[model samples]
Target: MYNPVRRNRNIGTENQGFGQNNRLQISTPYGTLKSFYERIEKYQKEVRIINDHEFLFIEEETRENCHHTCTFDDLESIIKQIPKEDYGDLKFIILRQPKRKEEILSPV
Candidate 1:
């Protein structure tokens, strides 16, 4: 009756009750990014999946919470592309971006 697999599954289920939310939360040091959030912009957040290794979330409207990346490698280039004013506030929780089949195939 003492099955290791069963026990692990039960333990995992119980651990789920810990109220863990795996979403990323980023903050900036200089507040240059904060100014972008003052007025509402149309593109608040955009999530992009780079290849299969990493993902990123870009908050266009708000500078204070402008961007987040699941992994650094996936977003290094994208991060550089962001205006210096908005890069300071970036933070992230580990996650992968979902992509549409067509979007992935579309010519960039």
Candidate 2:
């Protein structure tokens, strides 16, 4: 797993939110692109950018919460994945399907 640089300036432990301690506690967002690609290369997933409009990647079924939308990760992550300075016009090609059940001819 790739751990991003953690700055202690404004972080709170235990997933705290606003108004509880008068501030929000969140993980530091945006790591270096080198760290980002290191993660990708470690997983050996393929990626491609099309016409500066679409970004595509293949990921394995590893995390319980991960899906095709890639929302658990944020736009800070989106740039590393999409590599776009301006991401408003980017279109997506999501291709993920539930695994098909295997046939059981015999229960033995």
Candidate 3:
């Protein structure tokens, strides 16, 4: 009987697997934002987030990884996240918006 509404009632009987991990891995990136991990000055990261809602996680390596929104509107803040020391090591993005945009910053 192929019934989509039927729920499986089988319990206790189980097929075994070779390995299992019951703990969450903190190092792994989750949700919509990509994580940037490394050491950073604690309060400096906090100041950046206070100025912009677009700024998400901003913390040091011992505390947590930094996060920023990747959508078009907040992409500038994301670009600013790149550490100046690592500028040569990281690649830059060129978009056609101001990245083509000029001056008009508000909607009236």
RMSD to the hidden true structure, all candidates:
17.4, 19.6, 17.4
For candidate 2, the per-residue lDDT at 98 reads: 33
Model 1, residue pairs in steric clash: 24-93, 26-91, 27-89, 28-89, 33-63, 33-64
TM-score of each: 0.21, 0.20, 0.17
Question: On a 0 to 1 TM-score scale, where does candidate 2 land against the true structure?
Answer: 0.20
Task: Let me know the TM-score candidate 3 reaches against the reference structure.
Answer: 0.17
Global lDDT of each model? 0.43, 0.43, 0.36
Off by over 4 Å in 2: 1-19, 29-44, 47-62, 69-108
Q: Write the per-residue lDDT of candidate 1 for residues 1-108, one digit (tens) a residue.
A: 677666434355667545467543333347466532243344434454433333344433323533443444555566656665664544542332222332344322
Clashing residue pairs for model 2: none
Model 1 regions lying over 4 Å from their true place: 1-71, 96-108
- Candidate 3 lDDT by residue in tens digits, 16-104: 43235554333434553543222123422322232222333332323234333243346545557766554443332322111011224
lDDT of 2 by residue, 84-105 (tens): 5556665443333332221122
lDDT of 3 at 62: 31
**Window of ten residues with lowest summed lDDT in model 2:** 99-108
Candidate 3 collision pairs = 97-100, 97-101, 98-101
